[model samples]
Target: MKTIYVTAIFIFMAVTVFAQGGPPATPIDGGLSFLLAAGGAYGAKKLMDRRKNK
Candidate 1:
């Protein structure tokens, strides 16, 4: 029983540490993606409006 408890704790710690390893996301990357999406949306809306008006 004691061995099982220790093994469980070790596995939990190992998974938690490994799961979190990654390059942290840069703020600029997020901002650029958001800006691109917003610009695309705006352009699409403008194009649709022009088409509708025509």
Candidate 2:
């Protein structure tokens, strides 16, 4: 409970800092690469979860 809240707050702060000009501009991809990477990561996580439950 308390640990979850602390982790959430820390992650929010980290993402906030990252969104504030942390990475260089991607002219060609136009942020599609980020979305693709996130999707792939999410899919991998789901697969891992299913495997773990089985």
Candidate 3:
């Protein structure tokens, strides 16, 4: 469990680094939105699969 938590935190930090932009006016909204949507869709699919298995 400790290892899992550590890995999760590391992954989150890594993603934040890529999400950052150097330009003052740079926009990350588009990619961020896509990532959120994709994450939601993936969670929904996993939930559906879990239900089906049970």
lDDT for every model? 0.95, 0.91, 0.97
Off by over 4 Å in 2: 1-28
User: Would you list the rank order by TM-score, best first?
Assistant: 3, 1, 2
Q: Which stretches in model 1 have alpha-carbon errors above 4 Å?
A: 1-27
Residue-wise C-alpha lDDT for candidate 3, range 1-54, written one tens digit per residue: 999999999999999999998767878899999999999999999999999999
The local lDDT score (0 to 100) that residue 23 gets in candidate 1 is 91
lDDT, candidate 3, at 44: 100
How do all models score by TM-score?
A: 0.50, 0.47, 0.55
How many residue pairs clash in model 1?
Answer: 0
Q: Which candidate is the best by TM-score?
A: 3
- The worst-scoring run of ten residues by lDDT in candidate 3 lies at 19-28
Evaluated with lDDT, which candidate comes out highest?
3
